[model samples]
Target: MVTLKQIAEELGISITTVSKALKEYPDVSKKTRKLVRETASMLNYKPNSFAVNLRTRESKTIGLIIPVIVHHFFSSVIKGIIEQAEKKGYLVIILQSNESYELEKKQVDLLLSKRVDGILISLANGTADFKHLNDVIENETPLVMFDKIAKMVKCSKVIIDDRKASYKATQHLIDIGCKRIAHFRGPLLPQNSIDRFLGYKKALLDNGLEYDSSLVYICECGDMSFEEGKLNAQKLLKEHKDVDGIFINTDLVAIGAMTEFMKQGVRIPEDISIVGFSNWFMASVISPSLTTINQPGLEMGINAFKLLYKEIKKKKKNSDFSFKELVLDTDLVIRESTKN
Candidate 1:
């Protein structure tokens, strides 16, 4: 905890001289700057970020809120955000809402209280109200949403074409001769989930296949866990014996359903074909490898932070800027889970 006063006293210079020298101000001689920097380094002196922020009116930090932490896609997103933020000399403060609306609201409040320069968020599954989000805008903070987002909120967003991606997934199943295709959709609240479900249904009808409500399973808890997938698989088996294919919302859930089907003596692609979303790493290593939609999590993160950074700069300059909606692309990776 070395202080500027201590460094100044050691150098027998005024505190102002020491501060300016450390900052490499032109008013201080280059020799003095070099000496002050060397001495500061030797003393392991660290500048107080709070004091620097107060002087510049910028925290040099941003807040990031996500729905999950252990998820592969989200982890990749985090890495991209951190890498990009570091390049811009900014730090990220990450918080997980764990899919709870209340927690998401509170986390927003916490970041606002800290007076972060900007915020990037992927809304929680249970988030239906936008008051907390609107509060950030009302406070004139730069905000960007990625992945799961609310359309009515006036902010920049980074996301993929969920409906189009899901349509491709479901159409692939239909193309492979899956006449009776079922769906394991995410919770109803998130726009991505709703769009994905719509895509699945539209694909069925477009291909002259019947869309059955009974075949559509919902993850009521909104966690979209492996256990939920397994439970849905069990329910599907009991309720609809004719289903020959399924389009799952996530890779983990698809793997869980695959595991369940295998245990029940059902052969993948032979008895039933499956397609999942998100293209998680486990999708490739699993027993028949899963066919999935490749959501660009890393690219999403990079673009999200880039948008937030731009908005932050604009806000700082008091420049008028238009909100942007960036939709990244998605691809369907064909694997052994589906018929060739």
Candidate 2:
């Protein structure tokens, strides 16, 4: 609660002198600057952020929107974003969309009303319209997207090559002698899901295997739950007796399918090999470890925030800013779920 007036009065100096000295204005003598800093520290003085923001026209705050908070991959991304944002002296206000387009739009409006300096988001699966996102750009707010994103939005993005990564995963299954392969794909709206499906189909055709629409199961809920995976696996079992392998959209879903398959007396790898995406930490510790693509969630978050921060600086300086698309690398981590 210490104020500049109190410090100036205590030092018998003008309030203007105290302010300039604390700001390192250079017009103040080094001796005066040192003394002012020492007094401010001894008094535990905290500057009025509102006043500072008024002068700089910056809130020193950023908004972050994600679909899920409890998931391991998203938790890592949150950690990375917080770490980077703190280093730059910015506070992050996180909002979960819960995979709903309505909630996502409302959160965007809330963040804008708060006058955030920038925004970083991973679009919800149900978000098909770009008007809300476009409004952020039109309002001159720095926007950066990551993971599940909209390609039509003119903004910076940080993501892994989902298509290429999914292709590599399907190819791995094929390499291990999986001719009759099935896919458990995510919801239809997200770009990643569409790209992954394309990659799976391409891999099948490239390997001289037939791509059957019946073999590809979709997660209609957009939540991509484990129960959905189990249901799809059950459906696959009832429909295709000769299916020997499966490529799942996510590790959580893959684990669900594995659990169901085991419950039905089906042996993994010996009967049906499985591969998944986003190598969650639990993937390695499960009974039959999952073979999946390492999606680099933490790195994606750090890079996304860095890009947003850069754009924020550019906006502050009235400098021309160019959008950037950053694609991080993904690795196929081989484990026990698939035959090697």
Candidate 3:
């Protein structure tokens, strides 16, 4: 209920000074800033974001759009984003696309209506059309895409080297004497999934192993779900009884396949080796620790915020900027899922 005016009156300073100090303006002395901060903290003063936006023309709020927040990868990324955004005195508003283009477009429109300073997004699986995203760019709203990104959008992007990671995973399976390797891929529209599939094929060709069409199954499921993975695995195993290895696009899917494989009395590693992407927490705790590619989710999130901050600052300066695509490296974590 306390206002900035009340704090100013108690400190015997002008409201302008109090406001400037709260915003950490360089003109305010460090001592004054410290006193203002301490008093604001003690009073539990919450600034009116709307009033601040009206005056400064900036909401100091960033919008984040993800396919699904429950996924461990995205959850870690959100944690990183929250940590970095808080340090910069910015807030984040998250929206889940739920792997639907209609829902994703609606979320984008809602965020823009709220006058968010910038947006960070990972495109949904079903999002083949990018008209909504293009609208954001045309409106001069800064955007940073992470993980699943659209190739047509000219903006900063944060992503792991999917091709290299997938290649390494498939090659590892080959080294462990796996000739018949099957790939459980996600929706083919996203560049990330396509890159992974390419890597899977490259590894087989490089190792003198024949690439079989029957071994690659495209999971058309909108979101990466365990149920879809189980069904895919069942179909693959049923069709190809000689399958010896598997490379899945996600840990969740790999876990599902593993569960199904065990249910059918098939042994893991001993009978068929498996490699998963996104080294999630549960991967290590399962009956047989999973071997996976560690996608740096937290680092990706932090880097995305830093890029968005840069764009926001540039916009304030009215400067011309070039787009950048940041590709983070991935690590192949070996565990009990594949032979050492």
Clashes of 3: 0
lDDT per model vs. reference: 0.95, 0.95, 0.92
Give the per-residue Cα lDDT of candidate 3 at 122: 96
lDDT of 2: 0.95
| Residue 141, model 3, lDDT | 94
1-340: candidate 2 lDDT, tens digit per residue: 9999999999999999999999999999999999999999999999999998888889999999999999999999999999999999999999999999999999999999999999999999999999999999999999999999999999999988999999999999999999999999999999999999999999999999999999999997678888988998899999998999999999999999999999999999789999999989989999799999998988988999999999999988889989999999999999998987
Which residue pairs show collisions in model 3?
A: none
Instruction: Residues 1-340, candidate 1: write the lDDT tens digits.
Output: 9999999999999999999998889999999999999999999999998998998999989999999999999999999899999999999999999999999999999999999999999999999999999999999999999999999999999999999999999999998999899999999899999999999999999988888898999998789899988899899889988889999999989988999999998889998999999999999998899999999999999999999999999988999999999999999999999999
A best-first ranking of the candidates according to their lDDT comes to 1, 2, 3
Can you write out model 3's per-residue Cα lDDT over 51-143, one digit (the tens) per residue? 978989999999999999998999999999989999999999999998888999999999999989999999998899999999899989999
The weakest ten consecutive residues by lDDT in model 3 span 220-229
Estimated TM-score for each candidate? 0.97, 0.92, 0.88
- What candidate 1 gets wrong by more than 4 Å, as runs, is 25-31
Cα RMSDs, all models: 1.3, 2.2, 4.0
Once superposed on the true structure, which residue ranges of model 2 sit more than 4 Å away at CA? 5-39
- The Cα RMSD in angstroms, rounded to one decimal, for candidate 1 relative to the true structure is 1.3
Candidate scoring better on lDDT of 2 and 3: 2
Candidate 3 residues lying further than 4 Å off, grouped into runs, are 1-47
Task: Specify the poorest-scoring 10-residue window by lDDT in model 2.
Answer: 220-229
